[model samples]
Target: MEAQRDRLVTLCRDAGIGQAELLADTLSLLLEGARVSVQSVGTEGPSARLSAC
Candidate 1:
């Protein structure tokens, strides 16, 4: 995860990505993981945050 974050930061830097766009996208996997993990425990929370890859 640490390596992936570093790569993402590097990729964004190299590609000149804006902070807002990055934040909007970076949380996609977070929400996905949260949703999938919750399914295993048989519980659902309020609407999850939306994000794009």
Candidate 2:
């Protein structure tokens, strides 16, 4: 799985997606997923949510 994913990522780079664009999109998705996971934790205690991330 890791090898296939690496190949796919390499292909995306070769196909002209800039590193910054890739990072931005990846980070956006990750942050959204994190937000949902945090909210699912019953809104208890401190959270690692980063509004500006």
Output the number of the TM-score-best candidate: 2
Tell me the tens digit of each residue's lDDT in model 1 across 1-53. 55656666677777777773475357556655766765674454422332221
Candidate 2 — which residues are off by over 4 angstroms?
A: 1-18, 45-53
What lDDT would candidate 2 get against the real structure?
A: 0.58
True lDDT of residue 25, candidate 2 = 58
Mind giving the per-residue lDDT tens digits that candidate 2 earns over 5-42? 46656776777877844654575566556667666764
**Global fold similarity of model 1 (TM-score):** 0.40
| lDDT of each candidate versus the true structure | 0.57, 0.58
Q: What's the lDDT for residue 13 in model 1?
A: 70
